[model samples]
Target chain A: MSGLRRGSVCLGLCLVAALTANAQTDAPSRRSGYHDMGKPLQAMQDDDMANPGMLWVGEGANLWNQRFAAADKSCADCHGAVQSMSGVAARYPAFTAGSDQPVTLEQRINLCRTQNQRADRLADGSRELMALTAVVAHQSRNQPIAPPDDPRLRPFIAAGEALYRLRQGQLNLSCAQCHDDNAGRKLAGVTIPQAHPTGYPIYRLEWQSLGSLKRRLRNCLVGMRAEPYAPDAPEYVQLELFLMDRARGLKLETPGVRP
Target chain B: MGNAVHAEDGLRPYRIVGDAIPAPLTGEAGDPERGRAIVANRRVGMCLRCHSGPFPQERFQGTLAPPLTGAGSRWTEKQLRLRIVDAAQLNRDTIMPPYYRTDGLERVAKGFAGKPILSAEQIEDVVAFLATLKDQ
Candidate 1:
């Protein structure tokens, strides 16, 4: 009886050691892509006047106040001053009560447009959609990414984590392999980033335009030679959720500039 | 049956036997000097994007996969041919891209839809170059 008890104790100790090792390896120290940029690009992101993404942010401010004919009301009517939305973008990809899955900030905006404003939904990557998302996300600038704490989002987070780790496409590379394991390494003279989604509606020098997080995700999928999910695919939002959670303490840098 | 042509993409077909493509894709032998140039050029072979080898002139090289220093010593010419053609046939989870395969791929860019990343001649060139790298 004593031997059996001692054996169980050893097993318990072994489990704890395994779990600790897993946590250490899986959860590397969090660092934002911001730290990896050159001086000029970082300066561009910092200065409002110099930043090209601020162009969209300005347009977003206009759209926020403009009254739609169908709804006979502006976003400002219900939500009030745009500044009131401060820190809203940080806690995104959150669960809604009736919905089985979490909704991305983009999806939530579309839902509000269709349901409350009676306005036509904006297509993904459209100028108007990017403008509006930039304005909203810009409000949460410098705030730490804070994923919502709800049990309903647990399964979705797990699914997102699995997708991030799953090897796909002809190249057979996982997001984790590049963004997590080999982030600091160089690929074709460009440094691979940890790929935190703190900056959506970011302006990429390669694109020469402001783009959403989904658009960036699509770019990576294509780079890996994989079939990317659709614009409104749940996979993107789930992955976004996992990323926000992964970058829990990092400050948001919306309207960010990237080379 | 041995030298059948793939109809859709017009790729020169070669048979796979026991983890190696026993024959070359192109009928003629490849030029090793030209092959070395293709591997080093960033926009061409993209080999250095995921591998580091004897190229001292190149500043940045990837760390995602095994180094190519002893590749020739480690693999035969036939084995290297198959790997450059398509590593997926050997290991399903390999991160190496198939340089000479076009089918069974998902959502390839419109411009690159039916064309392989490297032509048959380019594949042979790369194979020739890789085979020359014996361990020091």
Candidate 2:
């Protein structure tokens, strides 16, 4: 009986040790928004031919090869093939030299356009831009999100964390309150997701079109009855950086479908 | 002011005392039946979006805030009125939206700029209904 008691106590001690180790090493377990989706939506995401966002991807392929009017240069002139950009989207919102702040993948695309192709910057929600972003991000599908480790990005990441936690709007709820604390719980028949930015230029069934992360962020702000930041606001980029870092190791799913 | 009209936004104004609004925006008491309808509705009160309560027929109630089962026993009608009017007065970080006040808000949508979420009568009615929830 004493031996059995000792064995039970040993098992309890092992359990406690395992739990402590998990708490010390691992952050809270993360579930992507995809998992929270219904099976039909998952099936839609799985089949590229069935996915509506692929229409934009096809348009992007055409745009990638077409010559720009200003410089007589196409995106293919500099970057050989779209496939070469694999894992590029995963390490985005990176701090590039000469620019003091970090730039999103969309910004990088615009920068390349203005500098290399001598083309005008595309508008925030333009179809051409969305198409191009969709195609480029599609190359990184299934790659784990890998936020860069530049020291310069530390302060911006910290700021993003602060904004995520800060309560605002007439509702006075923070992003962390819904996404972090109460994730997996129901709110008006919809499951509150962890707000990870693994997908971009995604096709939302509600929108019936592909949209960037900024558009979704704006929707959340409006839902909270808060004033959304401007299109070119640094706050949006900062938030994107924070979300990417938060979603490290999660697989990318550009042109993703969400209900 | 006890029952002043807010000249800026044209909303009926009431004074705040301590943690509660002592006076109702509408002079007369509100209908509890109408109040219950608003509370259960998805568009009007949106109460069930963040709060679960004694609502059995309603599916998918929220888990963000406290349940509304025993609101009457927990707080007085005056306190409930203040909460419905503007909960931020009591707790700065309360997720509850201010259903009455219209001023000091930022970047309201163009159509809803000056309009409060609920009318003065609606606020009173909701308060009345909440006061009847004595049983847990």
Q: Output the number of the lDDT-best candidate.
A: 2
The true-versus-predicted C-alpha distance at residue A13 of model 1, in Å, is 39
Quote the lDDT for A201 in model 1. 75
Candidate 1 lDDT over residue span A51-76, tens digit each:
99999999999999988878888899
DockQ for every model, please: 0.50, 0.50
Candidate 1: clashing residue pairs, number: 0
- lDDT (0 to 1) per candidate: 0.84, 0.85
How would you encode candidate 1's per-residue C-alpha lDDT over B29-133 as one tens digit per residue? 787788899999876788889888789999878766677788889998889998988888788666788888877775565556677878889888888888889
* Candidate 2 per-residue lDDT over residues B13-131, each given as its tens digit: 67777767777788888888999989998778889998887779999798777888899899998889888887877776666777887776665655566677888898888889989
Q: List the residue pairs that clash in candidate 2.
A: none
How many clashing residue pairs, candidate 2?
A: 0
| lDDT (Cα) of model 1 | 0.84
iRMSD (1 decimal) for each model: 3.1, 2.6
